[model samples]
Target: MANSPVSPSTNDDSAENAAHGKGRPTPSRAEQEAARKRPLVANTKEERARARAELQARREKARVGMEKGDDRYLPVRDKGPQRRWVRDYVDAGWHLSEWVMPMMVLVIIASLVPNVTVAYWSFLVLWVYIIFAVGNMIFLGVRVKRKAAEKFGAERREKGLGWYAAMRSLQMRFMRLPKPQVKRGQYPE
Candidate 1:
């Protein structure tokens, strides 16, 4: 059954020979021989690594070969400075805490409280507070990233100086660490 060829009864038949029960069907030797070939051997680690490297290189070539704004691809090139700026912000490892989500649930609960003082006025106040807190957290994240980049002597303008300055100022205000008050004679300020 493994080497079975195409059914010959389905082919053109002679009506006059049908009465004589005469028809020798042709056997496909090529297909039968193909089915008899030996299976492939198992691969070694080095062979596997080589195969993986080849596949990776192929994928990288395909990615790099695409035009900037080709609709078929994801358009690897950035549109403008604004889009690039946003992309950098997204790349800065910004994230909210696991506890923050639950705290937001608590905020919702507090907002739904039946008490007038706690719910009516305080709800709006708490909502604003939460927004600012989350905003400040993200702001501080970007700021710390910028300051670290600046402290290590990387470009500051690329990090968005205005946002970085605001975040740094906020952090300095809360942390209360004395700024480096360098005197005129001080060399490493």
Candidate 2:
């Protein structure tokens, strides 16, 4: 103790620290609240227009990011590894649903024929196409769920995917957003 070079705390040191804005006491609740207070509305039209422009700019950025399939900007429905896998799985396959639109046009032309048999057959073919489309979608959903369960978990298997899968399958591949990353027949592992 006699050889130690220790200095005791002093009021002068406290004053010096305070002068430097170091170790100062925290502001009271009222003081903090006053600092946060702001006008409830914009004071001028220019301010409101500037705010709107900023919001639009933000939305445009997000829109571009989402189109590029950036995970950060993806809506909740499209975000997640599981959703990506499902998208890849759907994109990598050809669906009966893909032919529905063209077949409908063909059927429309066929039905316009003056013959009753042709009209009946054309409508019948359309009905069959619809049934096949529905079946393919059901099959796709089951496969997606099974594969997702194996790769992800049972929780994913139970997730409602029937409608999402059907909607994606119904869309023409070229028209689908976050455009198909995988080529046809290149199913995701």
Candidate 3:
């Protein structure tokens, strides 16, 4: 029994186990390489500074592109040929809504006068002007939509383009973003 080859609790430190690995299977070379890979984001001070500089450069480029109305850098809402056409159409025309804000301001000042008659008349005029402006905007929107459909094809026209054109028309030409590429009376083909 003392000379038996088999033992219940053998503590073998075999050469085979040492070569292959003991507790768990050894990882492949590819797995080891993958495990050593680092994340893309900056991890050190110098890397952080470089990243910030790159970001600023990108932002500047985008800003310039947006001002120039370059499609690549324009916001999603303002992108697409349809929007450009809408802007062009709006820029080519004049609308009464454009003066509504200034007139409203005048009306408000008039309403603040000490005389009750002047204030009451100002209020009445303001309400009438508001109703007229709203109606004018609606008419402008419909006309724009019809023209856009004719020029760009009904299928290609964006849904909210009418409202977009109308709103842009209501704004003073110089104040509109993308800077009203087409001058007044220079309609788009």
Candidate 4:
């Protein structure tokens, strides 16, 4: 009777597709409102546990992606062929900047010594080493810019790319993210 010619049924498409239900009775208005309402803070242990598990899973996925150099998982700063090339270039060769950190530690220790002469000399040597290190870093930055410009396009290059390369070079090879695609002395062409 509902499907009579005088009345159009909503299930007219039933011939082409079967209607599927939630398999549970429809929720009441009060139940819906109650479900919609949640405390400002989750007081339930299950909620906290679920949240922690989700956060851990997200962080783990990101870490693995970062280590693998997966572009989708990488941060905006690290996402690009040019950045990868810079990382590879830096990792391929030992840089003066790498030792600068250890030198800085030594200098700090020497400066803490009771002997004024020792402190003075250590600071002086440190200043000289720092000057050389800065010079070396600048040289490397220029080389990175030039190489990247040649490999990529000069017009397409981003500003401060040289600085990015220089900073990456300062980090110890083993500590680099995306884990050094090139071996020492295997500089990218």
Candidate 5:
């Protein structure tokens, strides 16, 4: 046994390791980290300038795509077909609350009038309009949620979708992001 070059157990272990590649040496933590590390800033001025230009180009591309509502470049919140459909649905219809902000601005300007009668009237109008807008928003939210659930299924309906749709409805048609793919009165199927 002593004269033999390798023991029986050693031979069996080597055979098992060879079959599995388990005998190969593992990398050290530092070596692994070093391999992973990359220089964010390029070494040369020209290289740095090129990197910056490339980054700007990418950012511009993303901005254009996002504005166009391109699915590949859309944010996680706006990525899905359901969200797009919701936007289209909201855009195709005119909601009373869409004028709320502009009306509020008018109210504010009216309140600043030197005449006490005008200011008082403006305040009264503002309160009445706010109440009406709130009710309109509530109705819109309910309808949007119902439609979303019907089209996408209750399980597929995303959290905050109701609020998202309601908010989009509140914005002026021209001001909404991904710029109203569907024209007014042209609701998606």
Candidate 6:
């Protein structure tokens, strides 16, 4: 005679049956609330379409606010209080290190009037490229965060914070600091 699948007595399913009984207790109220608060991971096309529609609505709202010069919900453009800190830091930092040192070194090296004046100018151009590249990366990060915050909310804005932290670690690595890592079962704080 064939044995029933749900019967744990079957040798093939003894291991799984050992782990769980027929009846399980219900989850606590706190657990239920936590599950409700968790972000929904869409697994179906319908859910994805709904999420996209909601996102588009948010962007449209921000766009209208921006066109009307009311930035209460719109991302700050080139000039806004949100950009003040970023602009000041990037401008100052670039001027101090990205621009000043490379320009000074090139000028001083060229002062001796070596036959490689053309080469020195070429090197200066390369330095300018580096400054622009790094500056763009920084600007893109700040802009993305600002736009996300404006479109969605602060919680969603924090989603890209990991990338910013990674960039910071890379900068610190150049200064000889140890890269951050997880210890054992410890997770992100």
TM-score each candidate.
0.29, 0.67, 0.68, 0.75, 0.73, 0.26
Ten-residue stretch with the least lDDT total in model 2: 155-164
lDDT of 1 by residue, 1-189 (tens): 498787656534657556765366655899778888764752688877888899999777656543232224334333333323333333333233213445556767877887767766655765676677567666755654565465445653344543533343333221312222222233221
Query: Lowest-lDDT window of 10 residues in candidate 6?
Result: 172-181
Which of the numbered candidates is closest to the native, going by highest TM-score? 4
User: Where is model 1 more than 4 Å wrong at Cα?
Assistant: 1-29, 32-99, 155-189
Q: Write the number of the candidate with greater lDDT, choosing between 3 and 5.
A: 5
lDDT of 6 at 179: 19
RMSD of 4: 7.6
Task: Give candidate 3's whole-model lDDT.
Answer: 0.84
Question: At residue 138, what lDDT does model 2 achieve?
Answer: 89
lDDT tens string, model 2, 1-189?
489876878765676686776477889999999999999999999999999999999999988888778899987888777788888889989999978999999999998999999999999989999999989998988888788889877874547665677788889998887778899999888
Residue 185, candidate 6: alpha-carbon lDDT: 35
| Candidate 4 similarity to native, TM-score | 0.75
**Model 3, range 1-189, lDDT digits (tens) per residue?**
477686555555665555655578789999999999997887899999998999999999988888778899988988999898888888888887888888889988997889999989888888898788888889988988898899888997789987887788788776777777877899988
lDDT of 5 by residue, 102-133 (tens): 98899889878899999889889888987888
The total of clashing pairs for model 6 equals 0
RMSD, candidate 1, Å: 18.2
Candidate 5's C-alpha runs over 4 A off are 1-40, 43-45
- List runs of model 2 lying over 4 Å from the truth: 1-56, 155-158
User: lDDT of each prediction vs. the true structure?
Assistant: 0.48, 0.85, 0.84, 0.85, 0.85, 0.50
- Number of clashes recorded per candidate: 0, 0, 0, 0, 0, 0
Error of 1 at 25 (Å): 22
